[model samples]
Target: MTLQANAGQLLVHRVASEVAKDCFALATTFRGPGAYARGDQLVRAALSICSNIAEACGRGTIPEFRQFLRYARGSAHELRAQVRIAREYDPARALHCRTLESRTTLVIKLLTRLHDRPPPDR
Candidate 1:
């Protein structure tokens, strides 16, 4: 089956796809299988960003998509934060975290621009 690309939905899809790829890389690096398991949490948060965006867009409502974009942005931020936490635990992973952080920041910018509207005339 082929994925039909929708112009209105491109940004979210692109950002989400990139995020998913990075998350997969992150998951492989994560060694949090023991107590206080954070691996799953990180993966969930990362995936949630993309899933929420897709779900909202699928609903076919601008407002709904905006709201979901808010959550998606938050998820990106959460993943970035989690990456930092992991970096703290393992300094060597700083490079990986930095890369993910950069991509996540771009996602936030695109979402913010898409959702933010100009002020109405008085």
Candidate 2:
């Protein structure tokens, strides 16, 4: 892969990883009454974003890569929604939720840009 592609891939991976970590941390803050289910959904959505991005990088064709980027973007949106819910569910963690939401937005923007741009030769 070209250096530029490699750099872009690394950036996405790093940001996705951060989102996953944040989600996992946020999930732990849930307490009492449907906490487990809500936390699990948040974690799953966050992991999906990372997984989709990784899958996109491994795909042989640009089309496949773009498709996966779309999936990742969708997952990021899902995570954003979850973050909002969590913020409302636990006002004590509002700051963390806002931070996570911002990061998720960043991931969405990054994935969208990657999906729209012409792919480097694979």
Candidate 3:
């Protein structure tokens, strides 16, 4: 509820939004059947990362929030793997995938810092 925590949330939300946009762009850009399968997986993992972060931020306890952040981080890792496979199927998407990987790395760092913050009551 403090201004500081609110600012942190806004930052995370913005970063997450960026990641989601990248996912959508990459999914819609890459086309063949093989690319389709990998893209689908990538999109889902990307979406999960945002959803999990939202859930964590809204939770009632720090432990609950940390747990969800962990889930979100895991999703980021999953997306990394999926993007690698997607690149194999559609080499043209390599640049986008690399961009996504960089974004995901940033998200992971944000999540770690967010997780380490003191409980809201403190």
Candidate 4:
């Protein structure tokens, strides 16, 4: 693999890692009834983003990689939706949720770009 491709992959991985960490931190803030279920779903969505990216990198074909990237983007969107719901459910934590939502948006944009780009020469 070329240095450029490696660097791009690393960047995506780093961003996804940060998202996961932030999601975990956010999940810990959940409280009251139904909190556990909501937090678990949020955490799962966040982890899915990272896992899909990793799976994409592992795939042999560019099409497979792009497909996985799409999956990752979908997870990011799901996480963003959960963040929005959390914001409404816990107004006290709205600011934190907003921040996480922004991060998820960034991840979505990054994944979309990666998916839309032309396949690198084999």
Using lDDT, give the best candidate's number: 2
Q: Which model scores highest in TM-score?
A: 2
Tell me the whole-model lDDT of each prediction, alpha carbons only: 0.71, 0.84, 0.77, 0.83
- Best to worst by lDDT, what's the order? 2, 4, 3, 1
Residue-by-residue lDDT tens digits, candidate 1, 1-122: 22222434567568767777877777677665441356677788888887877765554556665677788888888988887887787678888878877888888787787567411222
Worst 10 residues of 4 by lDDT: 1-10
What's the TM-score of each model vs. the native? 0.79, 0.91, 0.84, 0.89
| Global CA lDDT computed for model 1 | 0.71
User: 1-78 in candidate 4: lDDT tens per residue?
Assistant: 411244235566688789889889888999999988998999999999988888787775777788888898889899
Span of ten consecutive residues with least summed lDDT in model 1: 1-10
For model 1, the superposed segments whose C-alpha errors exceed 4 Å read 1-9, 32-36, 117-122
Off by over 4 Å in 3: 1-8
- Runs in model 4 with CA error above 4 Å? 1-8
Clash list (residue pairs), candidate 2: none
Could you tell which candidate, 1 or 3, scores higher by lDDT?
3
Taking the candidates one at a time, how many backbone clashes does each contain?
Answer: 0, 0, 0, 0
Which residue segments of model 2 deviate by more than 4 Å? 1-9
